[model samples]
Target: MELTNYLGLAAILFAIGSATVLLRRNSIVVFMGIELMLNATNLVLVTFARMHGDITGQLLAFFVMVVAAAEVVVGLAIIITIFRARRSASVDDVNLLQS
Candidate 1:
Protein backbone atom coordinates (compact mmCIF):
# COMPACT_ATOMS: atom_id res chain seq x y z
CA MET A 1 0.00 0.00 0.00
CA GLU A 2 0.73 3.68 0.38
CA LEU A 3 1.73 6.06 3.09
CA THR A 4 -1.86 7.13 3.39
CA ASN A 5 -2.81 3.60 4.35
CA TYR A 6 -0.22 3.60 7.11
CA LEU A 7 -1.35 6.98 8.28
CA GLY A 8 -4.94 5.84 8.42
CA LEU A 9 -3.90 2.83 10.45
CA ALA A 10 -1.95 5.06 12.82
CA ALA A 11 -4.95 7.28 13.24
CA ILE A 12 -7.20 4.36 14.04
CA LEU A 13 -4.71 2.99 16.53
CA PHE A 14 -4.43 6.37 18.18
CA ALA A 15 -8.19 6.65 18.45
CA ILE A 16 -8.41 3.25 20.07
CA GLY A 17 -5.65 4.18 22.47
CA SER A 18 -7.42 7.41 23.40
CA ALA A 19 -10.62 5.56 24.01
CA THR A 20 -8.87 3.08 26.25
CA VAL A 21 -7.24 5.84 28.23
CA LEU A 22 -10.54 7.63 28.67
CA LEU A 23 -12.68 4.63 29.50
CA ARG A 24 -10.47 2.21 31.36
CA ARG A 25 -10.21 2.41 35.14
CA ASN A 26 -7.38 -0.07 35.59
CA SER A 27 -3.93 1.45 35.95
CA ILE A 28 -2.19 -1.19 33.86
CA VAL A 29 -4.74 -0.86 31.09
CA VAL A 30 -4.35 2.88 31.09
CA PHE A 31 -0.59 2.52 30.81
CA MET A 32 -1.08 0.09 27.93
CA GLY A 33 -3.27 2.61 26.20
CA ILE A 34 -0.60 5.27 26.59
CA GLU A 35 1.96 2.91 25.10
CA LEU A 36 -0.39 2.21 22.21
CA MET A 37 -0.69 5.91 21.55
CA LEU A 38 3.10 6.28 21.60
CA ASN A 39 3.48 3.40 19.13
CA ALA A 40 0.91 5.00 16.87
CA THR A 41 2.85 8.24 16.96
CA ASN A 42 6.02 6.36 16.08
CA LEU A 43 4.23 4.74 13.16
CA VAL A 44 3.22 8.14 11.82
CA LEU A 45 6.73 9.46 12.23
CA VAL A 46 8.21 6.52 10.38
CA THR A 47 5.65 6.88 7.60
CA PHE A 48 6.43 10.54 7.16
CA ALA A 49 10.13 9.80 7.19
CA ARG A 50 9.65 7.31 4.39
CA MET A 51 7.58 9.75 2.37
CA HIS A 52 10.03 12.61 2.80
CA GLY A 53 13.18 10.52 2.39
CA ASP A 54 14.67 12.04 5.55
CA ILE A 55 16.23 10.59 8.70
CA THR A 56 14.81 13.18 11.08
CA GLY A 57 11.47 11.50 11.54
CA GLN A 58 13.11 8.13 12.12
CA LEU A 59 15.47 9.66 14.64
CA LEU A 60 12.53 11.26 16.38
CA ALA A 61 10.74 7.95 16.40
CA PHE A 62 13.79 6.34 18.00
CA PHE A 63 13.90 9.02 20.64
CA VAL A 64 10.22 8.55 21.32
CA MET A 65 10.80 4.82 21.75
CA VAL A 66 13.55 5.45 24.25
CA VAL A 67 11.38 7.83 26.20
CA ALA A 68 8.52 5.38 26.11
CA ALA A 69 10.80 2.70 27.49
CA ALA A 70 11.83 4.87 30.40
CA GLU A 71 8.21 5.77 31.02
CA VAL A 72 7.24 2.13 31.10
CA VAL A 73 9.92 1.38 33.65
CA VAL A 74 8.97 4.22 35.95
CA GLY A 75 5.25 3.95 35.39
CA LEU A 76 5.15 0.24 36.08
CA ALA A 77 7.12 0.70 39.25
CA ILE A 78 4.64 3.28 40.45
CA ILE A 79 1.74 1.08 39.50
CA ILE A 80 3.23 -1.85 41.35
CA THR A 81 3.75 0.28 44.40
CA ILE A 82 0.18 1.47 44.30
CA PHE A 83 -1.10 -2.03 43.79
CA ARG A 84 0.89 -3.24 46.72
CA ALA A 85 -0.46 -0.54 48.97
CA ARG A 86 -4.07 -0.59 47.80
CA ARG A 87 -4.35 -4.16 46.57
CA SER A 88 -6.21 -2.80 43.56
CA ALA A 89 -5.03 -1.43 40.25
CA SER A 90 -7.94 0.92 39.71
CA VAL A 91 -6.95 4.36 38.61
CA ASP A 92 -9.64 5.89 40.77
CA ASP A 93 -8.00 4.46 43.83
CA VAL A 94 -4.81 6.36 43.21
CA ASN A 95 -4.85 9.74 44.83
CA LEU A 96 -1.28 10.81 44.92
CA LEU A 97 -2.36 14.43 45.10
CA GLN A 98 -3.96 13.84 48.45
CA SER A 99 -1.99 14.24 51.67
Candidate 2:
Protein backbone atom coordinates (compact mmCIF):
# COMPACT_ATOMS: atom_id res chain seq x y z
CA MET A 1 0.00 0.00 0.00
CA GLU A 2 1.10 3.56 -0.72
CA LEU A 3 1.86 6.03 2.05
CA THR A 4 -0.96 8.22 0.79
CA ASN A 5 -3.36 5.53 1.92
CA TYR A 6 -2.40 6.20 5.50
CA LEU A 7 -3.06 9.89 5.07
CA GLY A 8 -6.43 9.21 3.51
CA LEU A 9 -7.38 6.91 6.33
CA ALA A 10 -6.26 9.49 8.84
CA ALA A 11 -8.41 12.12 7.16
CA ILE A 12 -11.44 9.86 7.28
CA LEU A 13 -10.83 9.05 10.91
CA PHE A 14 -10.47 12.72 11.74
CA ALA A 15 -13.71 13.57 10.01
CA ILE A 16 -15.58 10.88 11.87
CA GLY A 17 -14.07 11.98 15.14
CA SER A 18 -15.03 15.58 14.45
CA ALA A 19 -18.57 14.55 13.66
CA THR A 20 -18.79 12.51 16.82
CA VAL A 21 -17.67 15.45 18.90
CA LEU A 22 -20.12 17.80 17.19
CA LEU A 23 -23.16 15.52 17.04
CA ARG A 24 -22.94 13.58 20.27
CA ARG A 25 -24.06 14.84 23.64
CA ASN A 26 -22.75 12.15 25.99
CA SER A 27 -19.58 13.27 27.72
CA ILE A 28 -17.93 9.89 27.30
CA VAL A 29 -18.66 9.89 23.58
CA VAL A 30 -17.26 13.35 23.19
CA PHE A 31 -14.13 12.32 25.04
CA MET A 32 -13.77 9.33 22.79
CA GLY A 33 -14.19 11.56 19.79
CA ILE A 34 -11.41 13.76 21.02
CA GLU A 35 -9.21 10.71 21.50
CA LEU A 36 -10.05 9.50 18.03
CA MET A 37 -9.08 12.83 16.59
CA LEU A 38 -5.79 12.71 18.43
CA ASN A 39 -5.08 9.25 17.11
CA ALA A 40 -5.82 10.40 13.58
CA THR A 41 -3.37 13.22 14.02
CA ASN A 42 -0.75 10.79 15.22
CA LEU A 43 -1.36 8.58 12.23
CA VAL A 44 -0.79 11.46 9.87
CA LEU A 45 2.32 12.52 11.70
CA VAL A 46 3.82 9.07 11.63
CA THR A 47 2.97 8.59 7.98
CA PHE A 48 4.66 11.81 7.03
CA ALA A 49 7.68 10.92 9.08
CA ARG A 50 7.94 7.59 7.32
CA MET A 51 7.63 9.18 3.89
CA HIS A 52 10.29 11.74 4.70
CA GLY A 53 12.71 9.28 6.29
CA ASP A 54 12.99 11.62 9.24
CA ILE A 55 12.25 11.25 12.94
CA THR A 56 10.65 14.65 13.49
CA GLY A 57 7.07 13.61 12.91
CA GLN A 58 7.52 10.50 15.02
CA LEU A 59 8.97 12.59 17.83
CA LEU A 60 6.03 14.93 17.64
CA ALA A 61 3.69 11.96 17.71
CA PHE A 62 5.37 10.70 20.84
CA PHE A 63 4.82 14.03 22.56
CA VAL A 64 1.25 14.03 21.39
CA MET A 65 0.79 10.59 22.88
CA VAL A 66 2.14 11.80 26.18
CA VAL A 67 -0.27 14.70 26.13
CA ALA A 68 -3.08 12.34 25.22
CA ALA A 69 -2.27 10.16 28.19
CA ALA A 70 -2.44 13.20 30.46
CA GLU A 71 -5.68 14.23 28.84
CA VAL A 72 -7.18 10.80 29.45
CA VAL A 73 -6.30 11.02 33.08
CA VAL A 74 -7.73 14.50 33.58
CA GLY A 75 -10.66 14.17 31.20
CA LEU A 76 -11.94 10.93 32.73
CA ALA A 77 -11.67 12.36 36.22
CA ILE A 78 -13.77 15.36 35.23
CA ILE A 79 -16.34 13.13 33.54
CA ILE A 80 -16.64 10.92 36.57
CA THR A 81 -17.05 13.92 38.83
CA ILE A 82 -19.71 15.42 36.60
CA PHE A 83 -21.59 12.16 36.35
CA ARG A 84 -21.57 11.85 40.10
CA ALA A 85 -22.92 15.33 40.68
CA ARG A 86 -25.45 15.54 37.84
CA ARG A 87 -26.36 11.87 37.43
CA SER A 88 -26.30 12.51 33.71
CA ALA A 89 -23.53 12.54 31.14
CA SER A 90 -25.17 14.81 28.61
CA VAL A 91 -23.19 17.99 27.95
CA ASP A 92 -26.34 20.09 27.93
CA ASP A 93 -27.23 18.85 31.38
CA VAL A 94 -24.13 20.50 32.76
CA ASN A 95 -25.16 24.00 33.65
CA LEU A 96 -22.27 25.68 35.30
CA LEU A 97 -23.94 29.07 34.79
CA GLN A 98 -26.40 28.33 37.51
CA SER A 99 -25.72 30.12 40.79
Candidate 3:
Protein backbone atom coordinates (compact mmCIF):
# COMPACT_ATOMS: atom_id res chain seq x y z
CA MET A 1 0.00 0.00 0.00
CA GLU A 2 1.07 3.56 -0.62
CA LEU A 3 1.92 6.06 2.09
CA THR A 4 -1.00 8.23 1.07
CA ASN A 5 -3.38 5.37 1.71
CA TYR A 6 -2.15 5.02 5.25
CA LEU A 7 -2.39 8.77 5.74
CA GLY A 8 -5.93 8.80 4.41
CA LEU A 9 -6.98 6.05 6.75
CA ALA A 10 -5.43 7.87 9.65
CA ALA A 11 -7.29 11.02 8.71
CA ILE A 12 -10.56 9.18 8.58
CA LEU A 13 -9.97 7.61 11.95
CA PHE A 14 -9.11 11.00 13.42
CA ALA A 15 -12.25 12.55 12.00
CA ILE A 16 -14.44 9.81 13.37
CA GLY A 17 -12.83 10.12 16.76
CA SER A 18 -13.26 13.88 16.77
CA ALA A 19 -16.92 13.55 15.85
CA THR A 20 -17.47 11.01 18.59
CA VAL A 21 -15.90 13.30 21.16
CA LEU A 22 -18.02 16.25 20.00
CA LEU A 23 -21.35 14.44 19.71
CA ARG A 24 -21.23 12.06 22.67
CA ARG A 25 -22.29 12.98 26.18
CA ASN A 26 -21.08 9.92 28.04
CA SER A 27 -17.70 10.37 29.72
CA ILE A 28 -16.56 6.86 28.92
CA VAL A 29 -17.44 7.21 25.26
CA VAL A 30 -15.60 10.49 25.11
CA PHE A 31 -12.57 8.79 26.65
CA MET A 32 -12.76 6.09 24.01
CA GLY A 33 -12.89 8.72 21.30
CA ILE A 34 -9.78 10.31 22.71
CA GLU A 35 -8.05 6.95 22.63
CA LEU A 36 -9.11 6.46 19.03
CA MET A 37 -7.64 9.81 18.10
CA LEU A 38 -4.40 8.89 19.79
CA ASN A 39 -4.25 5.63 17.86
CA ALA A 40 -4.82 7.47 14.61
CA THR A 41 -1.90 9.70 15.43
CA ASN A 42 0.23 6.65 16.12
CA LEU A 43 -0.72 5.18 12.78
CA VAL A 44 0.37 8.35 11.04
CA LEU A 45 3.65 8.32 12.94
CA VAL A 46 4.36 4.75 11.99
CA THR A 47 3.52 5.40 8.35
CA PHE A 48 5.86 8.34 8.25
CA ALA A 49 8.57 6.34 9.96
CA ARG A 50 8.24 3.68 7.30
CA MET A 51 8.37 6.25 4.52
CA HIS A 52 11.49 7.89 5.92
CA GLY A 53 13.21 4.65 6.81
CA ASP A 54 13.95 5.80 10.35
CA ILE A 55 13.17 4.49 13.81
CA THR A 56 12.39 7.88 15.40
CA GLY A 57 8.74 7.90 14.44
CA GLN A 58 8.17 4.40 15.73
CA LEU A 59 9.93 5.34 18.95
CA LEU A 60 7.70 8.37 19.28
CA ALA A 61 4.65 6.19 18.73
CA PHE A 62 5.85 3.94 21.56
CA PHE A 63 6.19 6.96 23.81
CA VAL A 64 2.70 8.04 22.89
CA MET A 65 1.40 4.59 23.75
CA VAL A 66 3.05 4.78 27.15
CA VAL A 67 1.52 8.19 27.83
CA ALA A 68 -1.84 6.96 26.61
CA ALA A 69 -1.67 4.04 29.00
CA ALA A 70 -1.04 6.41 31.88
CA GLU A 71 -3.88 8.58 30.73
CA VAL A 72 -6.22 5.61 30.76
CA VAL A 73 -5.26 4.81 34.34
CA VAL A 74 -5.88 8.33 35.60
CA GLY A 75 -8.89 8.96 33.42
CA LEU A 76 -10.61 5.77 34.49
CA ALA A 77 -9.96 6.56 38.13
CA ILE A 78 -11.62 9.95 37.73
CA ILE A 79 -14.55 8.48 35.82
CA ILE A 80 -15.03 5.78 38.42
CA THR A 81 -14.99 8.35 41.19
CA ILE A 82 -17.58 10.46 39.42
CA PHE A 83 -19.76 7.44 38.73
CA ARG A 84 -19.61 6.43 42.36
CA ALA A 85 -20.57 9.91 43.46
CA ARG A 86 -23.49 10.52 41.11
CA ARG A 87 -24.30 7.10 39.65
CA SER A 88 -23.99 8.61 36.19
CA ALA A 89 -21.12 8.88 33.72
CA SER A 90 -22.46 11.59 31.46
CA VAL A 91 -20.21 14.52 30.79
CA ASP A 92 -23.07 16.98 31.18
CA ASP A 93 -23.66 15.62 34.65
CA VAL A 94 -20.15 16.55 35.69
CA ASN A 95 -20.60 20.19 36.45
CA LEU A 96 -18.84 20.10 39.79
CA LEU A 97 -16.76 23.23 39.11
CA GLN A 98 -19.61 25.32 37.81
CA SER A 99 -20.39 28.12 40.17
Candidate 4:
Protein backbone atom coordinates (compact mmCIF):
# COMPACT_ATOMS: atom_id res chain seq x y z
CA MET A 1 0.00 0.00 0.00
CA GLU A 2 1.02 3.56 -0.68
CA LEU A 3 2.29 5.75 2.14
CA THR A 4 -0.61 8.17 1.83
CA ASN A 5 -3.18 5.40 2.08
CA TYR A 6 -1.43 3.96 5.12
CA LEU A 7 -1.17 7.35 6.75
CA GLY A 8 -4.80 8.17 6.01
CA LEU A 9 -6.03 4.94 7.52
CA ALA A 10 -3.87 5.60 10.57
CA ALA A 11 -5.30 9.08 10.85
CA ILE A 12 -8.86 7.81 10.68
CA LEU A 13 -8.20 5.14 13.27
CA PHE A 14 -6.49 7.65 15.50
CA ALA A 15 -9.48 9.96 15.24
CA ILE A 16 -11.93 7.21 16.09
CA GLY A 17 -9.80 6.17 19.02
CA SER A 18 -9.55 9.74 20.21
CA ALA A 19 -13.31 10.14 19.98
CA THR A 20 -13.80 6.96 21.98
CA VAL A 21 -11.43 8.18 24.66
CA LEU A 22 -13.12 11.56 24.82
CA LEU A 23 -16.74 10.47 24.56
CA ARG A 24 -16.76 7.31 26.65
CA ARG A 25 -17.12 7.22 30.42
CA ASN A 26 -16.14 3.63 31.07
CA SER A 27 -12.50 2.95 31.95
CA ILE A 28 -12.35 -0.24 29.89
CA VAL A 29 -13.64 1.55 26.84
CA VAL A 30 -10.96 4.18 27.28
CA PHE A 31 -8.32 1.48 27.55
CA MET A 32 -9.61 -0.16 24.36
CA GLY A 33 -9.49 3.18 22.62
CA ILE A 34 -5.85 3.62 23.61
CA GLU A 35 -5.09 0.17 22.24
CA LEU A 36 -6.85 1.04 19.01
CA MET A 37 -4.74 4.14 18.61
CA LEU A 38 -1.54 2.23 19.31
CA ASN A 39 -2.42 -0.47 16.79
CA ALA A 40 -3.18 2.14 14.18
CA THR A 41 0.21 3.74 14.77
CA ASN A 42 1.88 0.36 14.57
CA LEU A 43 0.25 -0.30 11.20
CA VAL A 44 1.51 2.99 9.86
CA LEU A 45 5.01 2.26 11.13
CA VAL A 46 5.08 -1.16 9.48
CA THR A 47 3.71 0.26 6.25
CA PHE A 48 6.39 2.91 6.11
CA ALA A 49 9.07 0.33 6.81
CA ARG A 50 7.83 -1.80 3.89
CA MET A 51 7.61 1.19 1.59
CA HIS A 52 11.16 2.30 2.36
CA GLY A 53 12.65 -1.22 2.37
CA ASP A 54 14.27 -0.38 5.71
CA ILE A 55 14.23 -2.08 9.09
CA THR A 56 14.22 1.06 11.24
CA GLY A 57 10.47 1.37 11.20
CA GLN A 58 10.10 -2.30 11.99
CA LEU A 59 12.41 -1.96 14.99
CA LEU A 60 10.48 1.04 16.18
CA ALA A 61 7.24 -0.82 15.76
CA PHE A 62 8.64 -3.72 17.77
CA PHE A 63 9.63 -1.46 20.60
CA VAL A 64 6.26 0.23 20.46
CA MET A 65 4.54 -3.13 20.71
CA VAL A 66 6.57 -3.96 23.78
CA VAL A 67 5.72 -0.65 25.40
CA ALA A 68 2.08 -1.05 24.50
CA ALA A 69 2.03 -4.46 26.13
CA ALA A 70 3.53 -3.08 29.29
CA GLU A 71 1.13 -0.17 29.21
CA VAL A 72 -1.90 -2.44 28.97
CA VAL A 73 -0.70 -4.56 31.84
CA VAL A 74 -0.07 -1.62 34.10
CA GLY A 75 -3.07 0.37 32.92
CA LEU A 76 -5.49 -2.50 33.47
CA ALA A 77 -4.07 -3.12 36.91
CA ILE A 78 -4.54 0.51 37.84
CA ILE A 79 -8.04 0.59 36.43
CA ILE A 80 -9.01 -2.56 38.22
CA THR A 81 -7.68 -1.22 41.48
CA ILE A 82 -9.53 2.01 40.98
CA PHE A 83 -12.74 0.16 40.16
CA ARG A 84 -12.42 -1.94 43.28
CA ALA A 85 -11.81 1.10 45.41
CA ARG A 86 -14.69 3.12 43.98
CA ARG A 87 -17.01 0.34 42.78
CA SER A 88 -17.65 2.33 39.66
CA ALA A 89 -16.02 2.27 36.24
CA SER A 90 -17.21 5.69 35.29
CA VAL A 91 -14.36 8.20 35.04
CA ASP A 92 -16.24 10.96 36.80
CA ASP A 93 -16.75 8.93 39.96
CA VAL A 94 -13.07 8.23 40.62
CA ASN A 95 -11.55 11.56 41.43
CA LEU A 96 -9.52 10.98 44.52
CA LEU A 97 -6.38 12.26 42.82
CA GLN A 98 -8.00 15.35 41.42
CA SER A 99 -7.19 18.66 43.02
Candidate 5:
Protein backbone atom coordinates (compact mmCIF):
# COMPACT_ATOMS: atom_id res chain seq x y z
CA MET A 1 0.00 0.00 0.00
CA GLU A 2 1.10 3.53 -0.68
CA LEU A 3 2.14 5.55 2.34
CA THR A 4 -0.35 8.26 1.54
CA ASN A 5 -3.23 5.80 1.33
CA TYR A 6 -2.28 4.24 4.61
CA LEU A 7 -2.03 7.62 6.27
CA GLY A 8 -5.40 8.63 4.86
CA LEU A 9 -7.06 5.55 6.23
CA ALA A 10 -5.42 6.21 9.58
CA ALA A 11 -6.78 9.71 9.55
CA ILE A 12 -10.28 8.49 8.72
CA LEU A 13 -10.20 5.92 11.47
CA PHE A 14 -8.98 8.50 13.95
CA ALA A 15 -11.78 10.82 12.97
CA ILE A 16 -14.38 8.09 13.39
CA GLY A 17 -12.95 7.22 16.76
CA SER A 18 -13.06 10.84 17.81
CA ALA A 19 -16.69 11.06 16.75
CA THR A 20 -17.52 7.98 18.73
CA VAL A 21 -15.87 9.38 21.82
CA LEU A 22 -17.79 12.62 21.50
CA LEU A 23 -21.22 11.24 20.55
CA ARG A 24 -21.38 8.12 22.67
CA ARG A 25 -22.46 8.38 26.26
CA ASN A 26 -21.73 4.76 27.17
CA SER A 27 -18.39 4.17 28.87
CA ILE A 28 -17.70 0.98 26.94
CA VAL A 29 -18.27 2.69 23.60
CA VAL A 30 -15.91 5.47 24.58
CA PHE A 31 -13.27 2.91 25.49
CA MET A 32 -13.67 1.22 22.14
CA GLY A 33 -13.24 4.57 20.45
CA ILE A 34 -9.96 4.99 22.29
CA GLU A 35 -8.88 1.62 20.97
CA LEU A 36 -9.76 2.68 17.46
CA MET A 37 -7.54 5.72 17.79
CA LEU A 38 -4.69 3.54 19.00
CA ASN A 39 -5.09 1.19 16.05
CA ALA A 40 -5.06 4.16 13.67
CA THR A 41 -1.75 5.32 15.12
CA ASN A 42 -0.30 1.82 14.77
CA LEU A 43 -1.32 1.75 11.12
CA VAL A 44 0.45 5.03 10.47
CA LEU A 45 3.60 3.81 12.21
CA VAL A 46 3.74 0.57 10.27
CA THR A 47 3.11 2.34 6.98
CA PHE A 48 5.93 4.78 7.60
CA ALA A 49 8.24 1.94 8.55
CA ARG A 50 7.45 0.19 5.29
CA MET A 51 8.02 3.37 3.29
CA HIS A 52 11.44 3.87 4.90
CA GLY A 53 12.42 0.19 4.71
CA ASP A 54 13.09 0.15 8.45
CA ILE A 55 12.10 -2.28 11.21
CA THR A 56 12.10 0.13 14.13
CA GLY A 57 8.69 1.63 13.44
CA GLN A 58 7.18 -1.80 12.91
CA LEU A 59 8.65 -2.95 16.21
CA LEU A 60 7.26 0.08 17.93
CA ALA A 61 3.84 -0.64 16.46
CA PHE A 62 4.01 -4.18 17.80
CA PHE A 63 4.82 -2.90 21.26
CA VAL A 64 2.00 -0.41 21.02
CA MET A 65 -0.44 -3.17 20.10
CA VAL A 66 0.70 -5.18 23.09
CA VAL A 67 0.19 -2.23 25.42
CA ALA A 68 -3.19 -1.55 23.83
CA ALA A 69 -4.32 -5.08 24.57
CA ALA A 70 -3.32 -4.68 28.20
CA GLU A 71 -5.13 -1.37 28.31
CA VAL A 72 -8.30 -2.97 26.92
CA VAL A 73 -8.24 -5.61 29.62
CA VAL A 74 -7.76 -3.09 32.40
CA GLY A 75 -10.20 -0.62 30.90
CA LEU A 76 -12.94 -3.20 30.51
CA ALA A 77 -12.44 -4.38 34.06
CA ILE A 78 -12.78 -0.84 35.36
CA ILE A 79 -15.82 -0.25 33.20
CA ILE A 80 -17.49 -3.38 34.50
CA THR A 81 -16.80 -2.36 38.07
CA ILE A 82 -18.25 1.07 37.41
CA PHE A 83 -21.30 -0.41 35.72
CA ARG A 84 -21.92 -2.61 38.72
CA ALA A 85 -21.66 0.30 41.08
CA ARG A 86 -23.81 2.67 39.00
CA ARG A 87 -26.11 0.11 37.35
CA SER A 88 -25.53 1.96 34.07
CA ALA A 89 -22.72 2.57 31.58
CA SER A 90 -23.42 6.24 30.94
CA VAL A 91 -20.38 8.44 31.48
CA ASP A 92 -22.47 11.31 32.75
CA ASP A 93 -23.41 9.36 35.85
CA VAL A 94 -19.85 8.80 36.99
CA ASN A 95 -18.79 11.21 39.73
CA LEU A 96 -18.00 8.97 42.65
CA LEU A 97 -14.86 10.81 43.76
CA GLN A 98 -16.55 14.18 43.72
CA SER A 99 -19.24 13.07 46.14
Candidate 6:
Protein backbone atom coordinates (compact mmCIF):
# COMPACT_ATOMS: atom_id res chain seq x y z
CA MET A 1 0.00 0.00 0.00
CA GLU A 2 1.02 3.56 -0.57
CA LEU A 3 2.04 5.95 2.18
CA THR A 4 -1.00 8.06 1.44
CA ASN A 5 -3.26 5.11 2.13
CA TYR A 6 -1.77 4.64 5.56
CA LEU A 7 -2.05 8.36 6.22
CA GLY A 8 -5.66 8.32 5.12
CA LEU A 9 -6.47 5.46 7.43
CA ALA A 10 -4.80 7.25 10.29
CA ALA A 11 -6.77 10.38 9.52
CA ILE A 12 -10.02 8.45 9.47
CA LEU A 13 -9.26 6.81 12.79
CA PHE A 14 -8.38 10.16 14.32
CA ALA A 15 -11.61 11.70 13.06
CA ILE A 16 -13.71 8.87 14.44
CA GLY A 17 -11.93 9.09 17.78
CA SER A 18 -12.42 12.85 17.94
CA ALA A 19 -16.11 12.46 17.15
CA THR A 20 -16.50 9.83 19.84
CA VAL A 21 -14.86 12.05 22.41
CA LEU A 22 -17.06 14.98 21.45
CA LEU A 23 -20.38 13.14 21.15
CA ARG A 24 -20.20 10.67 24.00
CA ARG A 25 -21.41 11.42 27.52
CA ASN A 26 -19.93 8.37 29.20
CA SER A 27 -16.50 8.78 30.75
CA ILE A 28 -15.40 5.28 29.83
CA VAL A 29 -16.39 5.76 26.22
CA VAL A 30 -14.54 9.05 26.12
CA PHE A 31 -11.47 7.35 27.50
CA MET A 32 -11.68 4.72 24.81
CA GLY A 33 -11.98 7.43 22.22
CA ILE A 34 -8.83 9.05 23.55
CA GLU A 35 -7.03 5.76 23.30
CA LEU A 36 -8.23 5.36 19.75
CA MET A 37 -6.82 8.76 18.91
CA LEU A 38 -3.49 7.85 20.45
CA ASN A 39 -3.35 4.66 18.43
CA ALA A 40 -4.12 6.62 15.28
CA THR A 41 -1.19 8.88 16.05
CA ASN A 42 1.03 5.85 16.51
CA LEU A 43 -0.03 4.55 13.15
CA VAL A 44 1.00 7.80 11.50
CA LEU A 45 4.28 7.81 13.35
CA VAL A 46 5.11 4.31 12.24
CA THR A 47 4.15 5.11 8.69
CA PHE A 48 6.45 8.09 8.69
CA ALA A 49 9.27 6.07 10.18
CA ARG A 50 8.97 3.54 7.39
CA MET A 51 8.81 6.25 4.74
CA HIS A 52 11.89 8.04 6.03
CA GLY A 53 13.97 4.93 6.65
CA ASP A 54 14.78 6.03 10.17
CA ILE A 55 14.14 4.76 13.68
CA THR A 56 13.38 8.13 15.26
CA GLY A 57 9.69 8.08 14.45
CA GLN A 58 9.40 4.54 15.66
CA LEU A 59 11.17 5.50 18.88
CA LEU A 60 8.77 8.37 19.33
CA ALA A 61 5.85 6.02 18.79
CA PHE A 62 7.27 3.74 21.45
CA PHE A 63 7.37 6.63 23.89
CA VAL A 64 3.84 7.55 22.94
CA MET A 65 2.73 4.01 23.69
CA VAL A 66 4.37 4.16 27.08
CA VAL A 67 2.65 7.45 27.85
CA ALA A 68 -0.64 6.08 26.61
CA ALA A 69 -0.29 3.13 28.93
CA ALA A 70 0.36 5.43 31.85
CA GLU A 71 -2.60 7.51 30.82
CA VAL A 72 -4.82 4.44 30.83
CA VAL A 73 -3.66 3.49 34.28
CA VAL A 74 -4.30 6.91 35.76
CA GLY A 75 -7.50 7.45 33.80
CA LEU A 76 -8.99 4.17 34.92
CA ALA A 77 -8.03 4.86 38.51
CA ILE A 78 -9.80 8.19 38.37
CA ILE A 79 -12.82 6.73 36.67
CA ILE A 80 -13.05 3.95 39.19
CA THR A 81 -12.83 6.41 42.01
CA ILE A 82 -15.56 8.54 40.50
CA PHE A 83 -17.77 5.52 39.95
CA ARG A 84 -17.30 4.37 43.49
CA ALA A 85 -18.18 7.77 44.80
CA ARG A 86 -21.27 8.44 42.69
CA ARG A 87 -22.15 5.04 41.20
CA SER A 88 -22.15 6.72 37.82
CA ALA A 89 -19.54 7.26 35.07
CA SER A 90 -21.20 9.94 33.03
CA VAL A 91 -19.05 12.96 32.20
CA ASP A 92 -22.03 15.25 32.52
CA ASP A 93 -22.34 14.31 36.16
CA VAL A 94 -18.72 15.19 36.94
CA ASN A 95 -18.98 18.83 37.81
CA LEU A 96 -16.94 18.97 40.96
CA LEU A 97 -14.30 21.08 39.27
CA GLN A 98 -16.81 23.71 38.31
CA SER A 99 -16.63 26.95 40.20
Clashes per prediction? Answer: 0, 0, 0, 0, 0, 0
State every prediction's TM-score relative to the real structure.
0.93, 0.94, 0.95, 0.89, 0.90, 0.94
Model 3 earns a TM-score of 0.95
* Model 6: CA > 4 A from native: 96-99
Q: For model 1, which pairs clash?
A: none
lDDT of 4 by residue, 2-91 (tens): 578988999899889999999999989988999999989998898889889999999999999999999999999999998888789898
Give the per-residue lDDT digits (tens) of candidate 5, residues 1-90.
557998999999999999999999999999989999999999999988998999999999999999999998999999999888879999
Which stretch of 10 consecutive residues in model 4 shows the poorest summed lDDT?
90-99
CA deviation > 4 Å runs, candidate 2? 96-99
State model 1's lDDT. 0.96
Total clashing pairs in model 5: 0
Better of 1 and 4 by TM-score: 1
Summarize candidate 2's per-residue lDDT along 1-99 as a digit string, tens digits. Answer: 899999999999999999999999999999999999999999999999999999999999999999999999999999999899879999999888999
Off by over 4 Å in 1: 95-99
Weakest 10 consecutive residues, lDDT, candidate 2? 90-99
| Highest TM-score scorer | 3
TM-score of 5: 0.90
Task: Give the per-residue lDDT digits (tens) of candidate 6, residues 14-42.
Answer: 99999999999999999999999999999
Q: After superposition, how far is residue 65 of candidate 6 from its true place, in Å?
A: 0.9
Clashes of 3: 0
lDDT of 1 at 91: 88
Give candidate 3's whole-model lDDT.
0.97
lDDT for position 70 in model 3:
100
The segments of candidate 5 whose C-alpha lies over 4 angstroms from its true place after superposition are 96-99
